[model samples]
Target: MKRKYNPHGLPPWLRSIRNVCGQFIVPICIFQGIRTLILPSILDVLLLFLLIAAVIAFQFEMI
Candidate 1:
C-alpha cells in the first residue's frame, strides 16, 4: 500500500510561529551564552546555558 501526501494534516501557519521563535531565540541565546562563559563559577549560569544549548541542538535536528 502507498500513502498520499497531505498538507492539511498539519496545522496552518505553524511556520510563522517557528520563524518568530527562531529569530527571538538566537539573540537571547547568544547573550546568555556569553554570560555563561564569563560566569562559569555560578551554577545557575551554567545550567541556563545548558538548557539553551539543548534547545538550539533540537532546532538543528529539526532543520
Candidate 2:
C-alpha cells in the first residue's frame, strides 16, 4: 500500500533530533523574513541565535 507523504509535518511535541531540527527550518525561514524587513544587520545575529537554539533543541530531543 502507498503511504501518505508528510515531509513537513511533525508530532506536536518534539520526539527526536530530526524532529526538532526539521521543525525549526520553517520558523528560521520566517524569522529571517521578519529580521530582514526590520534590519539586515540583525539577520546575522538572529541566525547565530537560531543556530544556538537549534543546537539546544537538538540536544534536548536527543535525551
Candidate 3:
C-alpha cells in the first residue's frame, strides 16, 4: 500500500511560499491567457504554457 502525502511535513516557509504562489498563479495565468489571445507571440505562448504547467503541478502537489 502507498502512504498518503502530508503537506504539514513541509517547512513553514515553504508552505507559505506555496500558498503565495497558489494565490497569485491564477491571476497571472489569466492575464497571460488574455495576452496570448490578443498578441499571440511565440514567447507569450511559451510563457503561458509554462505558467499553466506550474498551476497544474501546484494542483497535484508535484512541485
lDDT per residue for candidate 2 within 1-63, as digits (tens), equals 986645346655534656656677666767666776677776566785676566665555532
Q: Which stretches in model 2 have alpha-carbon errors above 4 Å? A: 1-15, 42-63
Clashes of each: 0, 0, 0
Best-performing candidate as measured by TM-score: 3
User: Where does candidate 3 have its weakest 10-residue lDDT segment?
Assistant: 2-11
Q: Write the per-residue lDDT of candidate 3 for residues 1-63, one digit (tens) a residue.
A: 997777788999989998999989999999999999999999999999999999998899876
Question: In candidate 2, residue 12 scores what lDDT?
Answer: 53
Candidate 1: residue 27 lDDT (0-100):
75
Model 1 poorest ten-residue lDDT run: 3-12
Q: Best candidate per lDDT, number?
A: 3
Candidates in order: C-alpha RMSD to true structure:
5.3, 10.2, 2.4
Candidates' C-alpha lDDT: 0.66, 0.62, 0.93
Instruction: Evaluate model 2: give its lDDT.
Output: 0.62
Question: Candidate 1 on 1-63: residue-level lDDT in tens?
Answer: 976644345556865665666677777777777777786667768667676875775476442
What TM-score fits each model? Answer: 0.47, 0.38, 0.83
Better candidate number, 1 or 2, judged by TM-score? 1
